[model samples]
Target: MIKYIGSKRALLPWITGTIQSIHHQVPIRTVVDLFSGSARVGHALKAKGFYVISNDLMTYAYILAQALVEADARTYSQERVQPILDRLQSLPPRQGWFTQDYCEKARYFQPKNGARIEAIREGLETEAGGDPLLRAILLTSLMLAADRVDSTTGIQMAYLKRWAPRAHNDLHLDYPPLLNGPGQALQGDALEVAAHLEADLFYLDPPYNQHSYLGNYHVWETLVRWDKPQTYGVANKRKDVQERKSPFNSKREAREAMQTLLGRIQAQHLVVSFNNEGFFAAEEIEEMLRHWGFVRRLTRPHARYVGARIGIYNPRGEKVGRVSHTENHEYLFVATHSRRVYNALSDHTEALQLSLF
Candidate 1:
């Protein structure tokens, strides 16, 4: 998986274990992940025998979910995918929007890699034809490959002053660890989806702050969309970043948004993950969730993203600001009508042990 800032990679075991512990009380057959950013949580749940419905607004995120969550590996076997990836890897370098913007204007990837990315993306559009699954798998492979060679601190918001060591490495595409199951990857607003969708368990992990995922991963967005959009700024972000805003990103609006979303969601159970740096205080989230029945809270302290630890730097690459506290708490709120489900989550020993990571 890609190195995402708010990724549930470290918390996967804990999250999955907490859900599994509830099996004795209420069997969870289907799970709906509202903000399936990177599809990490959805994919993990799917592997554990739950039918996952992963939804995200971003095109890149939808593509990722389609490849990992929806598309079954048993159908798109490695034996078949490896040969396709090998051919894509050997495509002749061709300069395009990605090369001109992200490579030359900004230094996200080396020009050589950027050209290859452009070529492979274009090649796949023709090669995959009308096959959504094939298109998703190919794009997922390309996106992960680009992520490995990106010269940034795990985001597309800005590039490092000097190219990172990994930037020099040759770009290579690998088959994503796709799980075998029946799942759906949707592209739309979480609120819109919650209005119509019903599930056994709903996982909500909305954006905590002003930073938008589309802005942070704009390069990937452009790659997956393949719609050479109008870009601006040093990082070459899509113009749509300024236009497409989430209510959850607003401090004043987040509280109301969360409350409304909680009310709109039709689920027997809900598990929400929010960062300490988020708009709502831990108590505020607890208060909102309490209306649903019984709410159990689990807190885990973890290091902040690498960029925050790097401190603030000027345009000239000089460190100008001191770093604040280097860690934050991830609060997991579990709300369910079943007392047994609440009790199970409260005493999920395996989950607590997994959180030690």
Candidate 2:
């Protein structure tokens, strides 16, 4: 998947280790992804047999997560889905909501492709009506389908002047295996939501720096949820909700939210993910976690580019363009109320790597 943001999958092995260290004896009881952007973390946890709760402010995020985490996995033989996609491709263009949606400057999806997508969307909606689980199954397929034609590497924010090999050639989308619906999606503040959840261990990967997720990929939310309301800003992006502010985005508020959140968690262990780009210093986060009885463990993984743009160009007409990936590394912070857990983390700088020993 061309993820709109970085995926936690890259650090799963290490995160699992940190979780083992903190709650070695107790069962997961519950795992909460308070900012479940795409629910990657929550899905990973569920696949490992843990009960997962996912939350996100964006309705689209909620929709995507709901399908990925809590919904029952559906098995559609390739024969069953291939015809549907073919029928979708054969559908005629219409001045429907989809055309308007894709034609938006923010969406940047071509009218021809958008019409096919509209057919798929309508087909899925019609097929899944009245059943939440089935709705999620079809939705997961739709999201992947939408990604297939996206002009940007991943997001529609910046289109490349050309396309990469995979994107340029032909996009043949295979439906993602359905997992579950957005797990307990909440359209409120993450800090507020995190405070109320009780779990054995809580993993926090709140937004970092000034990049507003909605600003970059608002269309995905629109695609999955598709309210298609009046929008504003650079590319007619949806201006549906009031923005949520936290210390993570603006350094000024980052501390206050961190303080409030760190003070509220009742979990025995807390693992926070951040990077050097964060305005709050490592020492400050350590101090906050320490005050809450969570000794902090810091791990720095090798930084790599994850957010890449994929597109293709035609001989003359405008086509998809080059790939642009973001350059960044991950920082894992483990905090535990147990001194034994803290000592384990404090004693080893190699805690960042995934070594099952």
Candidate 3:
């Protein structure tokens, strides 16, 4: 499934390599995805038999972790879970704010069937908030279903300016599915999430922009939470905390935040994923590790789909432009724990002084 923002589809290759690099020295049984959006890294780790802990500040992401990554497939008796999705597909539309269906982010999906999505979302909340797995499954199905009915091409909601796509008539969840792993999903800050769980490796994919996740997919998540607060605009827009922001997303404070996060890390091997857009540079992460006394560093370069056709960041269609796609250009830094290496590395290295990682 295509996540709204900060997808890991492109980074799996690098992640796998990084994990394997540490595996030879020590078995990686536990994996923590600190800013677990879409739970892609956590899911991959789970599939590979690593215990996963998925954490995100957004409630929808927590639900995603419960439904798609952590739920034991066996816990689902077809009798219980099957009926939920079954009812979802057949449930008629309702007249709530979201029931009117407006293109959420992509300017995708005109309104006709988007209402069905709103109804399904509310229905699931009313029905399964207590049953984490069931609620998550139903919520995920709803998000996917909403995307199918929307008018945009990808997850961005700016709307397709040239020509809108047709909404799909038939969409349903595929259940009796296997979502097995030993994991827990927490909805909170990235740093706090780390304080609670320490795994063999911690994979951090935080919000690299100043924009909040709540503001980006507020409609979908609001419906998932089922509060349906005051909405605005030609399309239904949920009320959001305009000032709500992540430390990693801000321009002025991202550096200090990164510094705090790196220092507090308990995991032996750290793997951080970020493109050129984040507040800190690639060298900044490496320098942080080195200062913490890390020796070896491994960097990888790969192609990324920035904005040729996706990852739209602006409101007007005019804002679309080329994003950096360095051929074999992405970077992942891995460091091993060695007391000698730690002692050898300077508390004051000139290379570590640079803030551009």
Candidate 4:
């Protein structure tokens, strides 16, 4: 998986444990990840044998879901994927849009790697005959490989002036571990998607602040779209970045957006992941979720993302000495309509505490 801000990679165990605890009470056969950013959580759920519907508004994220969640395990065997990798590795270097912008201008990757990226992307589209699933898997491989060698601090908001050590490495791809089950990937607004979809469980992990994923990861979006978009600013971000704002990014609109989303979700169990730094306080979230059913709150201490760990840097990539908090409190709110389900969670909580002690 690519390095992502606010990714649930470290919290996977806790999240899965919470889901399993609820599953012991109410059978969770289907799960809908309303804001499946990188599809990490949805992929994990699929691997656990739950049918998952992964939804995200970003094209890169949708591709990730298609590769890891929707693509069956048997479809991407080593024999099938290795030849593609070899072809990509053998591609002749061409200085196209990627090499000119990301490599020469922005310094996100070396020119060699940038040329490889461009060649591979073109190959995936033309050679694969634009087959969406196959393209998704191949794109995911390129995305992850690019992530490993990117010069930025786990974000594409800006590139380092000098190339990072990893930027020197050659681009390579490996087969993604695809889950063996029925899954679907969708690209649309979370609120609209939640209204039409019904599942045994709904996982809400919307953007918590004004930093939209589109703006932060514009490079990946451009790569996925391959639009040769008109770019602006020092980061060379796509122009559409301003147009793709979400209501959840506004302080005034976030509460209402969440309220509307929660109201429309039709599910037996609702599990929401939020951070203390979000616009709405924990109490406000609990109150909103309580309207649906009994709400149980779980908290965990987490380290902040890479950029936050270092002192703040302005758009010019200069550290301004304004440091953000190193630690964050992650809150998981579980809402259930059945009293039996609530009691089951309570018993599981007690057992977990006893075992910990």
| Best-fitting candidate, scored by lDDT | 1
- lDDT tens per residue, model 4, 1-357: 898996999888778778888888778899999899888999999988889999999999999999988988687666887788778868897888889998987888999999999988887876566678888888988999999889998888888767889999888887777767679999999988888998999988999998999988899999999989998888888999988789999887988899999989999999999999999788989999887769988877888988788766775657787765899999888899988888788777666545533
Each candidate's number of clashing pairs is 0, 25, 22, 0
Candidate 3 Cα misplacement greater than 4 A, ranges: 77-80, 101-107, 126-129, 166-168, 231-238, 295-328, 338-357
lDDT of 1 by residue, 1-357 (tens): 887998989888778877787765788898999999999999999999999999999999999999999999888889988888988889999998779999999999999999999889888977787889989999999989999999988887899999999999989999888888679999999988889898999999999999999999998899888888999887889999999999999988888888889999998899999978999889989999988899988888888889989986666899987998899998888899998787777568545766576
State residue 24's C-alpha deviation in candidate 4, in Å: 1.1
Model 2 lDDT tens row, 115-187: 6667677666666557765565466666776677666655555544444333433334455555532345455
Off by over 4 Å in 1: 349-357
Q: Tell me which of candidates 3 and 4 scores higher on lDDT.
A: 4
| lDDT, ranked from best to worst | 1, 4, 3, 2
Q: Model 3, 1-357: lDDT tens per residue?
A: 544556767667557645754664567887778888777777777777778888888887887888767787667656667777887767786645554445343344555465566566667766675877777877776776665655554444345565444464544555624465456777788776666677778877767768666766665667567775666553345556454667877878888887788777788777777766666677776777686456444444444433344544454556555654534345555555755433333332223323223
Each model's C-alpha lDDT? 0.89, 0.64, 0.64, 0.87
Per-model TM-score on C-alpha atoms:
0.97, 0.80, 0.82, 0.96
On lDDT, the stronger of 1 and 3 is: 1
User: Which candidate model has the greater TM-score, 1 or 4?
Assistant: 1
lDDT, model 2, position 132:
66
Q: What is the lDDT of candidate 4?
A: 0.87
